[model samples]
Target: MNEKQIEGLLEQHGIKLTANRILIAKVMSTLDYPISMKELETMLLTMDKSSIFRTLSLFKSHHLVHQMEDGNDIVRYELCHSHSEEEDEDIHVHFYCEHCHRTFCLNEISVPQVNLPVGYRQTAVNYMIKGICPDCSHR
Candidate 1:
């Protein structure tokens, strides 16, 4: 996405527009998969790790981004596709490629619905498929 579109998304999510945040969001918009904090830090070398972490935290709080643990024990973040303010309908399946160690967001494949007990409530859901991705399978 363009910088202006990224800015609009941040604004829509009630996040303050800052240079570092914009830069990070722009980079995130260009990515096709969830990224770890370490990877983001490497890509954005000019920004300090703490600042990036803080920005990510802020984004998470605002529902602009979602975090997931990619089987390797690394926390990764991806932009939220469902911008709903009330319910998190963006909960979708993720594919973790064991060979490349990459986490991909299967946006089209949504998480299945579950019927909880009378007193139970669901806040979030994570459904992941672990296998060799197309690239790895081809190789």
Candidate 2:
């Protein structure tokens, strides 16, 4: 998506349009996988640390973004493509490239229902698969 569309999405979440928020959100939206802010910092041209953090906080609060845990504990962020007004959490598969450290959201794969005890609270679900990504495998 273009920057304008991204701006609109951010606005939908009640977030003001700022250069850093737009920049970070654009990069996040463009990703085929969840990515680290460090990788994000590498991709950004003019970014400040506080701005990225604030943007993430806003995005998460609005359910516009979801955090995924890869094996490395980076607390990666990906677009909650399914998030809406009520913010219903769905179970989906995430792919992680060990060599390149990229995480992909596998929307096509859905998680099976699991039995839980009574009064269980499940806010979010994150399931990840790890291997070398195709690009890294050929390299």
List the RMSD of every prediction in angstroms: 1.4, 2.5
lDDT of 2 by residue, 1-71 (tens): 89888888888767788887788888888887777777777777477767787888788888878877896
Candidate 2 — worst ten consecutive residues by lDDT sum? Answer: 82-91
As for candidate 1, its clashing pairs are none
Q: Compared to the true structure, candidate 1 yields what TM-score?
A: 0.92
Worst ten in a row by lDDT for model 1: 81-90
Off by over 4 Å in 1: none
Residue-wise lDDT of candidate 1 within 60-85, one digit each (tens)?
Answer: 88888888898788899988865654
lDDT of each: 0.88, 0.78
Q: Whole-model lDDT for model 1 versus the true structure?
A: 0.88
Clashes of each: 0, 1
Q: Name the regions of candidate 2 deviating beyond 4 angstroms.
A: 83-85, 88-91, 131-139
